[model samples]
Target: MADSTVKNTYVKQQITDAMLNLLRTNELKAISISHLVAAAEVSRISFYRNYTEKEDVLREYINTLILGWHVEYENSDKKSEEEMLGSLFAHFSKHGDFYLLLSQRNLFHLLKEVLKTLYGPKPEYPNFGAYVAAYFSYGLFGWIEEWFARGMQESAEDITILLKNRK
Candidate 1:
């Protein structure tokens, strides 16, 4: 990798780690740019150059996670809804600390925004496929949010079974 690319990645990672740490104990709206930069050990300019706002850091991290999961999902033999959901639950379970923090902080809505971006019913489009995709995304998000709410106590297989048996 180029020098600048490596530096930029380092800066972004620093900011992301700082944001997550802050979100653990502080409210999202309460954290200021000054506090974030101080916690991140990066300059304000660095933060602004890489991210427009605080939420962008969290959004980018979530996007990275979803992208990783997408790659795994693509590679796995997850042809059915049960298989796909089982994979998803396992992924979230592995990252339970980060996700549990988001749940505690009431930040799961950001996941919905990221999902919409990836599978959108674009505001201008009038198509059944778009609506179907959007509906599916929303429904999946509902399951994820509820799973987080329940402290993710159940095993992924158990949750998949529950979803399969839902009336």
Candidate 2:
């Protein structure tokens, strides 16, 4: 069981790496499964076993990054809104290159999709709480989208300061 989990993780990592590398020079639409599998050094069977489509690889990678951020945020002992904002900006800044690439490729929607998955309205939430969650998520996503559109000129710290001051 452990071996199977390890193998799956390895394959997924390979696919994610290959997809990111390919997206560096190639449009996502231009990338084919054969090319992706060959670049990943994994067989088609392995690719199919891990993912159904090329976009899935990117989505999975984005999800992993977001989940990583979530874990860090949860464990950081952030007690203030400013600290939380700092953590958020820092994480996004750390991966600015990949995010920028996604923006350039018109694939920022993938990030938005992941954010929706994380913060979208939930069945468990009351009606008001669900709308509030969706509202906050969409608003936060809009800010990030604008930052990317602006070429990310401001440093992460600068962003944290700006938002912190706005409150």
Candidate whose TM-score is highest: 2
Question: Which residue runs of candidate 2 sit more than 4 Å off their true CA positions?
Answer: 165-167
**Residues 41-120 of candidate 1: C-alpha lDDT, one tens digit per residue:** 99999999998988899889999998899898989877897898888888888889998898898888998898788776
Off by over 4 Å in 1: 122-126
Residue range with the least summed lDDT across 10 consecutive positions in model 2? 79-88
- Score each candidate by Cα lDDT: 0.88, 0.89
- lDDT of candidate 1 vs native? 0.88
What TM-score quantifies how close candidate 2 is to the native fold? 0.92
> How many clashes in each candidate?
0, 0
